[model samples]
Target: MNDHDRTASEVAHSLSRRQALKVAGGSALAFAAGRVVPSGADAQTPPSQPADPMQIILPETGITLPTDEVTFRWVDSGDSKALFFRAYFDAFTQAHPNIKFDYLGLPWTEIAQVVPLGVRNGNAPDVFQVPQEIPIAEAVREGWVRPIDDLIPNFPAWQAGFPPVSFVEGVNVFNGRVYTFPRSTSRRAGIVNYFNRAYLEEAGYNPAETPLTWDTLRDAARKVTENGQGQYYGIILVGKQVGRWEQYVRNMGRLAGSSAGPDDIDYRTGEYVYTSDGYLAAIELLLALRDDGVVFPGSMSLNDPQARAQMPQGVAGMIFEGEFTLPIWVRDNPDFEFGVSPIPTPSASFTPMGYQNTGTNHQWLYAESKLPEVAAEIFTYLGSEAGQLAFVSITGGSDPSVFDSVNQRAPVDERMRTVYGIYEKYMRLCPDVRIKNPETSQVYLRLQRPTPSFGEIVQGIYTGQLEDPKQAMQDLQDRQDQALDEAIEAARRDGANVSRDDYVFPNWDPTTDYLESDYAELG
Candidate 1:
């Protein structure tokens, strides 16, 4: 059967209603064993009308829900996060008694493959979590997902409560339409320096006072490392992992005020600045750290998990991580103490630039779902202070909340509070290259494609395999530009409303902020 041709009834009926966990006739029940049907006489009687919604004091979500029986299917990623969602769903179910949830949980690896295929097969989850790497615009453009602006009647009013930057063009809204709501921003929303208190104290430095400049940081690292005399090391770098390397490079590059990192684009000119001076400076610093013997000896060979293992064992003095790292460390070693601070720069005079507002894990409603209204209600609830707070608390308040009310309820750990405070002030959305061209949008997704992998390039530099950072970066730039040009030309031939002119900016100045005026078009 053609997936697009399936009717709502066909889709709904096709699901294994026999096995679904159900709340039938306002009564909670486990997964139904098998479909139970009324006999001839019992089936003939008139069905009872649903209880008056006005009478049910559904916990105040601040939004009104229509009185209807709704069965919502929701798929999510990650086991820990899934537990959080289940708790939220339970709370939601208690409030909206008429609705039932058929929850499906899968890891991100499976989710990327399963969700879209499931949706096309007409076995779609009404509300599904979209991974950060997926091209949301492409999903919407291809008619795989729907806009929530019209589906949720109170969406506009509710969205207005969030930070205005949340709706920046190409960040959240695409082509003036809102499709997904960010469940939470990156836990490490800004550049945070996570350091071990014991190590700092052992080195005769104050843990509470983080180094503000890169020179001081390097000195501190050297002092703590003691020329690799003990098991203790200055830092952990997962040189083999692209994400870990990319993060450090981007945060450092920001201080130098240039476009860098995999996601960074010169908003002013729509140009790839992977080879910018700031990026080179970042690499040079890493190389310097390596030469100083401050980095863990096995860093070049280790992956993220292996590298992070050094933290809990007190073998590393400092690390760069997001807010979530604190909780994970706490869970592993409750007695261990640490401090959080901003990533150090070359000088205090340099502007702090690692401000990133890129939405990481977001939730999108399937356009083909039969119960969008119900999904919208659940979506709004999840984004609410009450819902976000539940997740923050479950995650140990390490992940900062998007709403002020939820942050107010954040755990009073000094480190968490300090990190959240910095996040509130400095977090920003990085310029997106994904929205720039046909090819760039799929850069993260199409790993098999011919573009250079930032991970391999960084690993080469770290292992002394790649001699010149500048030449390597320039080569990367040439290849990336070529890919973009080819994609643009192909798109134009296919009658796409895009041109090379959309990417050019004659008046762009790298020294100044790439404000909205710098761009000819956002694309």
Candidate 2:
């Protein structure tokens, strides 16, 4: 059967021998050897008339663009980089005119609520960015999402461009089946400092030359705030989004020598690092800054968009965000001179920030979509060499591609280039317990999140709702430790082949990429 003719069930169904053969005999050629879009158009495939989008041929891909009338929807907590996705959806429609490519951008808070509701009502987008509030494993086990390994032609070729651990069993994969490909990478988000060049300079600091450390960040913010005299502030943040608190702490905490950094798991011991010394220090610094009254007075109520807009109007000196901040500033506040740097550390000396090797493992496809083929096609195309390259070129590295080849060739400004350098120099791939034991996915499904989660703890402490930061973190940590132990046991009882030992990695190194070969050494 032609791809456009399959039902959603058939589209997501496991690849049978016959289906495998069909995929092999069909469009495998498009993705191989880094050639998704044909550079040279063949004269034999003449152009179709433009009046009808269905009849239009994509000269670049050498594929006749047409399909049965279908509405393909995608949603995300959209960002500046979403421009690239919006454009791709339009082009995708041109390639398959029958596809009414509908894109929806919502705040992640709404998305967290919206996705599960949509899935329950059978009205979710064909593809939606994972809210992270709902565990992916639970979603997969409940039949809300299916494996993507069978969807693409020559899956291996498509997966190769991504770095090691891009897909992990307990993470983006479950039971040997991959669920999603990271359309973006972590380097693009929540690990960089966006500073107003003038404010930093007036405060007698060069952010680019002297990256903010815990103490220095405090001093700088205080000095800038004093200069503002209540008119503007030292920094603005999306205090309404609790996640930003944890992210900023993690970024700086990692830079200050936290073993876990952003991963939250210290690979060396395979344990949580919520109360790591660096993490505690980062919290103290933030608390001191807040006590200094350097934080914007209205920051607590503002969302990211509001803070981002306010920053250019001189409301604050800095924001710790991803690379995506640069482009929006360029577009909306072009005259606002600014600079970027790695997130501040607790101390002056640098410590490598660790990340799970998985790319931006945020988006996922809904299981019961009416246009699964079209959804799959969009994912396949984006991961393609052509798609990745176009993404960078169009977005100008607003949200970087996981593929380095594309980012290396991207046309972006100085700030993006500077931060990409920071990402390369400091980013290390941490160990994935999933590669050693896939059964941990069950543990995740069963694992209860500790009361007053990391974000909540940070918020509570920052806002004075929590009296003692260390005690609060330790309490949460203990709860998490106990919760994890209980979850592992429960999963084991449920016949999952997981053990508490599965989470331990005695030989793992914090400074290097934990590849399969590293895991093999254990065996």
For model 1, residues 1-523, the per-residue Cα lDDT tens digits are 2112323233223323322233434554331111111112123421121121101111233445557887788877533344345444554565567877776655444566788788779776877775433546556656667778776656777787665456544445655677776666653543477788877777766635645477877888898899447788888776655556766777677666774323555655677777888878988989988988898777776644455556777778887766656655554456677887777777765543433344455777887887776776666655665456556655556555666566665443567788876654444434334334433333222222233456567768777788989888888777777766776666556555565565554554433434454343443
Pick out the ten consecutive residues of candidate 2 with the lowest summed lDDT: 29-38
| Index of the highest-TM-score prediction | 2
For candidate 1, what is the TM-score?
Answer: 0.68
lDDT for model 1:
0.59
Span of 10 residues, lowest total lDDT, candidate 1: 49-58
TM-score for each model: 0.68, 0.84
Q: Where does candidate 2 stray beyond 4 Å? A: 1-68, 160-162, 186-189, 261-263, 515-517
